[model samples]
Target chain A: MKSLLQNLARWLVPVCFIAFSFSEEPYQLKLAMSWGSDFPVFSESPKRMAERVAKMSNGRLTIDVIGSEEHGRPLDVFDMVRNGEYDLGHSASYYWKGKVPNTLFFTTMPFGMLPLEQYAWLEHGGGQALMDEVYQPLGLLSLPGGNSGSQMGGWFQKRIKNTESLNGLKMRVPGFAGEVLSELGVVPTNIPATDLYEAMSRNVIQAAEFVGPSTDFNLKLHLAAQFYYTGWHEPGAELQFLINDEVYQSLPADLQAILKAAMRASAYDTYVHSVDVSAQAWADMRRQFPTIRVKDFPDEVMSELRRVNERKLVEFADDNDQARRIIESQLGYQAMMRNWTLLSDYSYLESIGR
Target chain B: MKSLLQNLARWLVPVCFIAFSFSEEPYQLKLAMSWGSDFPVFSESPKRMAERVAKMSNGRLTIDVIGSEEHGRPLDVFDMVRNGEYDLGHSASYYWKGKVPNTLFFTTMPFGMLPLEQYAWLEHGGGQALMDEVYQPLGLLSLPGGNSGSQMGGWFQKRIKNTESLNGLKMRVPGFAGEVLSELGVVPTNIPATDLYEAMSRNVIQAAEFVGPSTDFNLKLHLAAQFYYTGWHEPGAELQFLINDEVYQSLPADLQAILKAAMRASAYDTYVHSVDVSAQAWADMRRQFPTIRVKDFPDEVMSELRRVNERKLVEFADDNDQARRIIESQLGYQAMMRNWTLLSDYSYLESIGR
Candidate 1:
């Protein structure tokens, strides 16, 4: 009897193995983001990304995404994801300045570097290594996302008469920009997502900043402010992607390549959205919100601010070695890119003006 | 003299106004993030949010914090902020899945969904609206930034003879219960930082998973097996902050409240970093790496996969609206989430898993 049972077990295992080997498991994936469908990040990028990745993987893996509002509030995303509540999430960095100060360098700085320069530093410099160092402690890895090519100055409710006007002014700003504003005597503030519209509409703040015209138009800034500013401070900005450390390490190398390709698609989408939508959004705002006023910053104002920006850099370098290193690297790159820009993009614009 | 002065006056009038108004130019803002920061989303409970917000706001309205790795790779952050870049950026969102496919949801998904129920529903429900809705044509808004909760099952080296055979497999694992491996097949692959020494030894990997102690000790698997298996769809994920659009609309009344006292401070230094270095990071992974083996999956493995999981709601609903609602909501959310996930995250995971 025992011999017969053993023989049966061996055959059963082998038979099952042969049958299962020929089949594949149904696969599915999940993605989480803090923003809603209206947000350009996911609408323009993630959706397309899902389709491309699926095709590349031959349907072996499938994905599903949940927006921030659908999952949790914007702030809850990090914890939810870390806790394994969501497979993926889309978010920002400054929101967590309390935990890692160094992270600020990657996000943005007051009079820091421009988008192109920042990208150079991140890809070639030790930025990725440094970032991993911080995240490793938490079992996470990171990747690059999208980039907004420079941004316009924020909207204004009142015009300035002099530098003195900046004193005691309440402003909504983040990162290094806030520090720069502080130097000019402006008080900076930070608020959550839901409350922004209410605060701006209710007069809780004197000045505020969001993104570019496309985004601003969506938020209906035209109804609240009178003046639109130019883009001199933030020439460009990049987005990012994060991963759980253990999970990332487990992925096959080829899969990693596919992921990179998908991300590139998303980035392209964001870029195109910004370019295609900004002009139209602005035009619409002009027609719908006639009260809105658009204008550029005076060259003199830009020049003086640029001087202050230099001073701020010196101050930052004085305290931290990393800051000094970053500044030096950034400036060096800027010098190199200066000629590149002048010869490439700038020349075309100049000729058009003529 | 009057005629000559009139000519000078015309040009001087506009130049003087620009120069004088330069002081009043809208303040620039930049938001940043790091994986380790303690933020409003992932750090302390909501009860503690007020105090932190108060400190940063100094009695004014506070900036909202969605600090974590919700956006993209921590390294790419600088790019997002530099170009007027992103006014704010979170830590890392699946390391740029938006730009990379397979990697997109890996930051958070794998098994998908855990941490706290409250957070899970938030993401699966309308919470995404709070962040995504606010960021549109412009390139900005807030995002998830906190998380460190549930995780994936981990990888294994050897094929399982049965569900119980998950034992004795070699595997690489981190966080939570990496300590419990004695009863399981795992040999445990404990590699050190950077070097991941034990894993480099490549002794096993027959079957492994360390996130749960069962896989940790059993997989001592990194040393023993050739196959690695795990259920960890998502290990500890995090939220990220996104801020490009809001930073642009600096003039809206409600927008101004977006940046203020304690909240801003909470988002930056205090809240952002703490979450990354949670207690889980303090555990060691060295003891398990010595004797793991690797393994592979056999044919006809598990049955009732897609059909079972896909119809899970119908089976579990039990005629209750609430039950149906839960399943329906999950399905609905998954439907939306899948559109993008399939295109990017799913394919990436599969490509690598293969």
Candidate 2:
């Protein structure tokens, strides 16, 4: 009787397993991204989130990632990922302005919040959930994937004599910064990577900003634009992973965690690598482009730019409800940061004379 | 003549370095937080970041983080960090609803974006810059330093029956999700950690959502509430490292990058550890709380809750211009993600099922 009961219980366990697996239409999701085939983000953080979910359910739940731009161009990533054409896509949010203008705020801004400030606003300031409210109706899930530390201002061709020189100067600027520049009389232009070199060489654009020296040199823009500037307008630029909603819903809980963990790791790597390599890249660019004139924007020009920025912000706030909230939150944090900076950054620098 | 020039250049380099170091003013920064001195989030990331920055710059920069309710309650972290009363602080964003209503989007949301999503929105989606617009005037800077992935729903004394049960229910929730819950009629409360146990035990609050299994189990919530729920409303909850703008600006460029990089590493660790330990904690919880009932919220509840969420969204969007832009950008990304998830998550799962 004991043996029979034991045997029966074992068989019953499998039976129950099968029943549970079919409990609600077996939501098995496969999230494919190019970097890792289907689940590149899994490599960074929420490590093993996907795998854990799969194993817990005894193969009843599974999520796979396809990394690399195997599906399409990096630019096409946001659309492909969001439309459910692919399960997910890993690309920078700044790269998708054609789809969403404000999406670039998540990645970067010209002379805006650093990574930490961005984190505070997103988490405590109702930024993250607001984004979800924005995404869920479209059947998508968004996640922060990676970050690039303060970026080097883009390589430049000629010295910026004054704020006036920036006027009507066609440059490959994107997103809200572009809007701000346009307000400052800059002819902001958007060009894909393939066309950047030709544009600069032909003087179709006077200067351009592309990530840092590592990425900028990769495009060989240093050869065309001999003047390189610092102060990344898009400081704290971040990358993202876009996953389909239904597909994410299908994932087992554990797998979801793994995907998150992996992506976090990847993001760390991206930021670390960017920071470590950019400095070296800048050093190399100096050697490679000996004629490159490195100069900082004049204080007066910067002051004017700041003024224009304030006006544009107010205008944007007036035009867009969401922009108003963001500006309020951003300005709130900046006020605090400025007070802190004045005491710490300013005082320390004064003492050290750097 | 060559030797004299070389000697002059060497002396000039040292003098210039010294002058550069001392040229800037020092700003006072007071970082306040609720965690104990031993807490990793409060202690580790900032220490490493500051140490790394100082070392990289050969002691040209300095950062200090003080912990343990130094400012007041954990709920006050955002204000302290944002107001420049604290040069820096470690806290979750959801705690600051009184000031920045939309800030939670960067942290975690119910069935919303995960850590990766938070990063995505913050880094690429204009989330970072937008938040800066929120914080710049506040004199604050924020970076995501840690994350808790797919947290346990909460510890409850009674099982959640229908969506109606949420009405008038006192629950501890932070961020925009808290607002969503409020829309669903839940009384959202923000409580510091020290008070959670007493509040739950005394029936001051019937339900509470903490981080994950590890943190919850450690806090011994099972002793108070026997019913454990799955399906984390806030998956991949993020923790932020904040710095006063004054403090951040005071640092040298290289030091700033170093600090950013180190924080990135800490943020990565936070997620990895949470995901890894949660699994083990679940097993332990099962062993310890044999009578604990684990249940999932009814589908009807989720659907109804979502409907309420939509109403709140429209209302907020109509009122705030920034919210509107973010909604548009987020909606666009969501649409794209939906298509991607279908192909990657759904299609792959279906194939495996076959």
Candidate 3:
């Protein structure tokens, strides 16, 4: 009878191995996104990622995406994901600069690399390793979520002609860019997106900086401001996906690959979608509001802003070694990439006469 | 006794179903590529796609990639895939122009939209549907494989200051751009990659148009040529992945999704890789050879080339209804996208004086 039981155990071991190899256990992960439920392209990114994950994983891995409206913690995505309250979160890295100073350089900067250039830096120029170094200590893994392309600097009630025009000017520009503006005597303010239109219409703010045409058109800021300045700050703002290291590690190898591939494809799709929507929206806005005038900030003002920007960057890099390394990496890569950009796309556009 | 037999059969059916559900068969696919095995980013794209598919599918699907060097057929990828001789092919749409004239517009056109703009048109504009219309009739499915970004025009032995300089110019340029140049009395030739350096050095060809810095620097063209021209043709050349439709449909749903996600991610990565490599190669070349001069064709030459290109496009459109529709779609979208490009990235770059 004992010999019979041992033989049965030997037979069952191979059976269990075969079943385990073929029948993967299903995993369900929850994702939090930093947008409202109804947000157009922004909301669509994580949803697309989830759908791809489900399809590619053969229903073995499913991701449930919830917007900030449902989660009620738009600004706390980093904290939530790091603490393992959620498996993942989609938000811009710069939003967490207050908590992790090194996070600021991962998004975009004043007069920074464009979308492709920034992507090149992240994927090939040690930017990803630096990013991991900063996030790993906090128990988080981050991937690029999407890009907003080059942003529009702001909408202004009056054109900025000189450095003096910025003096005592009130505007709603947030983050590092706002700090740079304040150096030029602009009174930078931050307001909720919901209040932007009302603030501009009621003269609560003299100028407002928001995203480009796609999202900005939703707020109807064009009706309130006549002069639209092209982007100087946030040249190519990239959003990020934050995952808890433990949750990521707990997945099977195949599921991990599926999650990463889905996230990457969705991020790229979002950028392409932004480009499409922004083009259509800009064309529509200009057609309806024929009086809208696009202006570039004057050379004098731009030079002063660049000067102040350099000063602030140096000051920020003084204390923290990680911050200093990140800034230097970006600056050095930007210089090399900008040279190529000037030779290729920049030259092509110029020769064609925009 | 018959009733007992029937009961036994019914019991065995459920057990068979459970085992079948837990054990999936592995699938293998064969892919043919246009480039040689040593080709840098171009060859890497399909290889990367195969790797991701294997990982994401947990070894359920494996792809074997064959390059032109091994297959001895560089331009027959479309036909091979369609005929089921190969399950997939990595090539460019423009290569099929001889067989299907409409395939020409899917790849980059002379003086067409840049990379992101073209991607937007393909994804959000009607480009993909149109591409499907062209390829579906041939029993193939196509996806964007990768982009070379904006290519440098070509290496020139002499600076071309006017259209007259192009008369009897023995240059090796290919495809529709070559056709356009032929109108200006330039003799456009096609030479094998192995002979490009020798041809240019021996005065067998006064100029040659190849891919940009990353690939071009490999041929040592700068050693023989003094002037490098920025691209007027192939602004954003996108390679394609062609799959046999029936073979694609044969895959289980999850494997199908994995294949597509892998391709998409690999394609985007290839583009990012190109941007990085090109930037690094260009910087290195300049540092090593400071004498290489980069030039843009003068306005006289550019306007004339544009005029000829338009004429050819019109002539080509007249013959085929599908061709006309595709060209019109591109033109319409380009008109709208160019406006946004001018307002956003173009404006920002000009403001910075790169």
Fnat of every candidate, listed in order: 0.00, 0.02, 0.59
Please give the DockQ score of every candidate, comma-separated.
Answer: 0.01, 0.02, 0.40
lDDT of 2 by residue, A10-78 (tens): 545544433333343344554544343433222342223344334333354455554454544546766
Error of 1 at A331 (Å): 2.7
In order, the Cα lDDT scores of the candidates are 0.47, 0.60, 0.89
lDDT of 3 by residue, A119-216 (tens): 89999998999999999999999998998888998999988889999999899999888999999999999998879999999999999999999988
For model 1, the superposed segments whose C-alpha errors exceed 4 Å read: A1-29, A76-87, A110-121, A124-130, A133-137, A191-202, A287-291, A298-320, B1-354
Docking class of 1: incorrect
- Give model 3's share of reference contacts: 0.59
Model 2 CA RMSD to the hidden true structure, in angstroms = 26.5
Name the candidate that leads on DockQ.
3
TM accuracy, model 2: 0.47
Query: In candidate 1 chain A, what residue range of length 10 has the lowest lDDT sum?
Result: A345-354
lDDT of 2: 0.60
Interface quality of candidate 3 as DockQ: 0.40
Model 3 residue B321 CA deviation in Å: 1.1
> Which structure among the candidates has the greatest lDDT?
3
lDDT of candidate 1 over B75-194, digit per residue (tens): 676356535644665554555534532223323432233322213334435534423432443355445444444332444443466546645555455422232333243455555332
Shift of residue B208 alpha carbon in model 1, Å: 64
Model 2 bad stretches (over 4 Å): A1-354, B1-30, B40-43, B73-83, B164-179, B182-192, B195-205, B338-354
Give the higher-lDDT candidate: 1 or 3. 3
